[model samples]
Target: MSAEHTASAPAGPLWRLALGRSLGRSRKFLWFLLINILPLYVASDLLVTSGALAKISGFLEPVMSLWGLPPEAAAVLLAGMLVNLYAATAVAAPLALSWQQVSVLGLILGIAHSLIMEAVVVRQLTRRYHALTLLRIVLGLGAGWLLALVLC
Candidate 1:
């Protein structure tokens, strides 16, 4: 048997401990999604229904235009940057984005998503958290811009 399997303590207790932690983490993820993402999604629907999304899109259109994205894409990018992919995806679901637009967003958000939360972990790991986070945002958007130029 392997050394790990032959530890002094039997495997059953270790397995149970791992399982318990896994379940705990899973529950936490579900709860977080429910409380955070669900409300954003409902708000998105409300914005759409109330015709407020147009105003929002118009206001953000200038920044989004940099990547050939529609103003509505600002919500997706903002959600990804401030929160996480789950929030971004929820915001994006109602938008009828083209394949090119989706690809560009996927490329950008993949690198730079979850900035505020991730910065804490980055700060823990490195002293240059500010530079690193800024670099990721620049690189992600730069790459997305190049891709959008090519695709469009």
Candidate 2:
């Protein structure tokens, strides 16, 4: 009876532990990063060059001012989303943005970036929209607002 119950039970610690070990292997992690990094970089460059970056900047610039950001901050924000943190930093650094603006950008990026891919990834993981996606946007904007208030 005990053996039957054990066999029928769902996978336990051993399965989880093995999975964790496999994931922890550096080769797998490196391969995963290698697979993704190039596409993200190329797409980020194209987005910036194709004027999408300018358009997004135009939209966000006004809203960002409330957070004490400059108009050009839109570039940084969009770059961060399209590329990653490093690319955004490169764009923003040349602007020599105020401390408040930097903080705000940090807050916004923390909540969401690479949004399209992320949405798909989230859907795959949860098998349902948990509505947290909306929360991410709100939190990003609110966080920027709060950070601006605190810093400025």
Candidate 3:
């Protein structure tokens, strides 16, 4: 093709278009991550500093024992479900957990985290948010339980 024809081509290189679109998407994703995660981190820090986390952890001790995790692990799981993995990590970072416990928690949260935000997205796309949300929670719990049984 002549230089003029190529320069004015109706369809440019496919990869270039794709890369541009992906870069745009990544920028939006970074913004979304910052907006969602910053508040969670601050809240987690406040909860920890105020001793409220310890009280909540104590209350959740029995329930956490069922999963072979420490009471404080409940805060991590809650943060993951309610906010995101960053929030969960904030909660987990201060705790002392074995590799096995962290692994099990990872498996569980991988299956189910950011429920409210994700459910809204799912609802917009699939119109079955309730069912999907329930399924994710069940799967996460089941996986965690199974992992605990094997690892603990």
Candidate 4:
């Protein structure tokens, strides 16, 4: 085979191969969203509608109050850690939090959201998943407290 002809053939096939692989990945991600994110959105909506979230918030009031957050803020933090940021926002939207409270919550959740799903990812990447998970929670709480001191 001629050198130029072999080079061009490989280049053309490589481009098509990369495009096909990317399309396959996109389809897989779309299915992942439908299976995972859609149910979380629905469950978060139901929690808000049923008032069960309020009950959970009430129970966590004292603990949350210690961090300079409202009782309702507990639900947002719990949702963020257990589910994802979208679930947390769904819980947070109706609460009418002050700027300080929102800032603190944002800092905390940014540090330690999606514990279950993320822990699995962490475990896959490292053997110290338990320690890392604990560290994240502690860091998130500490950051929230520091933000409350400054912002609140």
TM-scores of all models?
A: 0.82, 0.56, 0.69, 0.66
lDDT per residue as tens, model 1, 1-152: 66664344555777786787689999999998899888988888788668788686888888888888889888889999998999998888777788989999999999999998999999999999999999999999999999999887
Q: By how many angstroms RMSD does model 3 differ from the true structure?
A: 6.1
- Per-model CA lDDT versus the true structure: 0.88, 0.70, 0.84, 0.82
Query: What is the alpha-carbon lDDT of model 4 when measured against the actual structure?
Result: 0.82
Clashing pairs in 1: none
- Which ten-residue region of model 3 has the weakest summed lDDT? 1-10
Instruction: Quote the positional error of residue 106 for candidate 1 in Å.
Output: 1.5
In candidate 4, what are the lDDT values of residues 39-144, reduced to their tens digit?
7656756776687766777877778876788776787898899988877876677676788898899999999999989999999999999999999999999999
Q: In candidate 4, which residue pairs clash? A: none
Name model 4 segments beyond 4 Å from true: 1-56
RMSD of each: 3.7, 7.1, 6.1, 6.4
Could you tell me the lDDT of residue 64 within candidate 3? Answer: 90
Model 2, 12-108: lDDT tens digits are 7767756666678967757655676555556656765686656766767777678888666777777777666766765666565677677789889
Ranking by lDDT: 1, 3, 4, 2
Q: What's the lDDT for residue 28 in model 1?
A: 100
Residues 1-152, model 3: lDDT tens digits: 56763334447786786677789999997887688666666776777678777787787878898789978788899889998887787678656679989999999999999999999889888978899999999999999999999999
lDDT of 2 at 137: 70
> What's the true lDDT of residue 3 in model 2?
61
